[model samples]
Target: MTDLPHYTEYDTRLAAYAVIRDDDGRVLLALWNEGDQPRWTLPGGGVELAETVEEGAVREVLEETGYDVRLDGLLGVDSFVFSPAQRSNGSERPLKAVRVVFAATVTGGELTPEVGGTTDEARWFPLDEVRGLPRVSLVDVALGYLAAG
Candidate 1:
């Protein structure tokens, strides 16, 4: 007789993000050094334990972009599932991510880079020019909601 181990485990992650823009139609973005290449993405990160989604978005924005923002409202929600190779065992693990997006306005603070973090720098980019830059999928999804409303 042959014996096989069977188990199914998935990680459910919750994250929050913001779509922030300026009067000149420039959108704020953060440079994330994730893999072999860095990409620009909306400012946000994983929701912390005991923190509301809105509060998480606000905190992540400040941590990644050094910008204090006032959240205008909830934009939308996005969810997806993917399998990533586990570094420890070389096995594939399913990750389901649920993201909450919000529209925000910059209240104060200067543009600065996050130190020793997933994000390296933060800057404003022209909306028209964003499509040409390397960016995360969340950027477009968030912008779609903002444009529709």
Candidate 2:
């Protein structure tokens, strides 16, 4: 019998995000500072084990943007796979990211940047200007949902 290499187990990450837009034709975004270069993204992140997806989305939005949001409805889900070499965490196994996206409305709270967190800044960008901003792929996915809805 010939010896064979063992297969490595891949990891799956479940996250929640919100697409919040104001009546003034501006969309909320947070600067993701954990990567090589900071880029704008939706205000949300990994879902905690103890919370539901909806709860996670709300919590993440609050944490990143300092905005109290009420989720109106689920917009869509985005799935992407990162090869081991492409992962920022330096893991040897591939990672599958499953992101749950929701449409949300700001009920309260003011626009404030996150402190001591993965995101350093939060701001509202005019819809037309969003296309020129440096952002992650998730932003495009969320915007696609907005266009379709």
Candidate 3:
């Protein structure tokens, strides 16, 4: 739970995530082990100061799943508001989260778990099996974009 986002200040963050699928239509997902329990999510994280969202998505995928991937195109964006567990004031100060999702294809690398990172495991799950897994809304939203397309 220590690696989960904790807000000490109010700020808007822009993040990027990758939706990588194989020939079998199995999506690559990372198991985030920082919350109350591990949950599956698209491989992504906050974009760095000078990095483009696409580059950030590539980097996050590599860092989380050890997979090299090529960006296909921008799928869609997802946004939400939530209060961080650690807040300074007692009032509910919600952080606005804007996430950019990209359609991507794996270029290389093997499936491996991230070390000393927010994600502890990475795996490919069949599209139909994803709904049965414990996951974040990001996963559903990303998949929805693909479904709509």
Q: Can you give the TM-score per candidate against the true fold?
A: 0.88, 0.93, 0.87
Name the weakest run of 10 consecutive residues (lDDT summed) in model 3. 84-93
Q: Tell me model 3's lDDT, rounded to 2 decimals.
A: 0.89
Q: What is the per-residue lDDT of model 3 for residues 1-149, given as tens digits with 9 covering 90 to 100?
A: 47645666556789999999999989999998876779999999989999999889999999999999999999999897767554333545667789999999999998889999989899999999999999989999998999899
lDDT by residue (tens digit), candidate 2, 32-102: 99888999999999999999999999999999988999999999999988888989889988888999999
Error of 2 at 84 (Å): 1.3
Clashes of each: 0, 0, 0
| Candidate 1 lDDT trough over 10 residues, lowest sum | 82-91
Model 3: what TM-score? 0.87
User: What residue pairs are clashing in model 1?
Assistant: none
**Which candidate number would show the highest lDDT if scored against the true structure?**
2
**Model 3 regions lying over 4 Å from their true place:** 1-9, 85-92
Scored against the true structure, residue 1 in model 3 reaches a CA lDDT of 45
Candidate closer to the true structure by TM-score (higher is better), 2 or 3: 2
Please identify which of the two predictions, 1 or 2, would achieve the higher lDDT against the true structure: 2
Candidate 1: regions farther than 4 A off: 1-8, 86-91
RMSD of 3: 6.3
Estimate every model's Cα lDDT from 0 to 1. Answer: 0.88, 0.93, 0.89
- Write down the lDDT that model 2 would get: 0.93
